[model samples]
Target: MSNVKNTVIVITGASSGIGAASAIKLASLGGKVVLAARNEEKLKALVAEIRNAGGEASYFVTNVTDKTSLVGLVEFAIKQYGRIDSLVNNAGLMLFSDWKDVVVDDWEKMIDTNIKGYLYAIAAALPQMLEQGHGKILNMSSVAGLHVGGSSGVYSATKFFIRGITESLRKEVGVDSGVQVSMISPGVIDTGWADKVSDAKGREAAKALNEIAITPEQVADAVAYALDQPTNLTINDIVIHPTKQDW
Candidate 1:
């Protein structure tokens, strides 16, 4: 594993879940971290916590859906840290709606935030990474991307796109630019993503299932493993799930 010292990492959705945990873990390992998300208060709190612990950190109010906001985030990181070594595109949403009852608005929101957000982040970071000739991009995917299930058609489709894009980028970039692209597919995570489930039965089921979900910190650890790899090494994909999860 490479030392985290002096590494500059930019993370989206850094206010909570895997993003927040990854920020803290990377900082603790001596990496300078930039936290980007729409929640200003939460981002500030996380930044303060890292600083108090003697780690370098900063916060930028970023809405991943907005391309300009993403551009600003990349610029902020460069201005603050000199160079960005990695980007964790972790912002996403999961809405529980059966295809029969799906609302077009909700479907669009899921597609935009879960899929387009990743693309925008890549679009903003790639130019800088290409110029640097070395970078790592970690994307947050879900097991739903691999398996189709009830009430997750649209959400799973978005994740499937994530998986495809990450793999395609990996091949396109190759080892020439020293850029590594990978995806982490987690199942049954204990994040508050289930809180977005509005259907009464689906909400209850999701809550019960999440009772056995893995902690966000666990996923963060996986991300740290990928980042810690030597420049010559690349982890193409990681699939993580609670041991008890059957599907």
Candidate 2:
């Protein structure tokens, strides 16, 4: 039996990278994927692509950093599919910078999108899932959470926070409720994020680091594997880094 068949799954950051890849993959597996992101154009195109492939999908313009947008996203999914089976929290920011550079603005951006954005989405979705009696939550993190480098202090800290949140959610909610909680951590994915880095030095470093990075689809595969499981079994966490990437 397909664990994702006919299930309604909501994915944040569905406009690009791992989120978009996971949305396509899950939809192909008979999942009704609701794409949520700030980029309406990309989300619409992705939804159209999924539908053209004979997969069920829809788009909802959402700014994960905004609580109201998250609430609306969850509402949109429930309105379209009646219930949410899973949530893929994949939106995040990684503006790497050294401590001496004191890029406080970058730090705040990461905290807002990576940390609070996740919490806001959970706040919007958890209640609905709890009432429905069964659901799954998959948070996207980074290997940086496991080992922080010199320039990724704030970005890594946000992922570490995600790790902590996933554990707490599993223990507090998944222990008894039908809800399941899981996290997928990937390292140095080639998602064009290297060019998006704001700090000049950090951007160059990120580009070099991405030379040994894996593709977003690879991380999406890990996400699928974690979600495609029996209800009685929860794949708690998955760590996926390129074989060439050492430490």
Segments in model 1 whose C-alpha atoms lie over 4 Å from true places: none
Error of 1 at 75 (Å): 0.7
Candidate 1, 3: how far from true, in Å? 3.0
**lDDT of prediction 1:** 0.90
Residues 81-111, model 2: lDDT tens digits: 8999999999998998899999999999899
Task: Write down the RMSD of candidate 2 (Cα, Å).
Answer: 0.7
Which predicted model would earn the best lDDT?
2
Candidate 1 lDDT tens digits, 125-215: 9989999998999999999999977777888999999999998899887467779998899999988978888766667777888988999
Q: In model 1, what lDDT does residue 64 have?
A: 94
lDDT of 1 at 189: 92
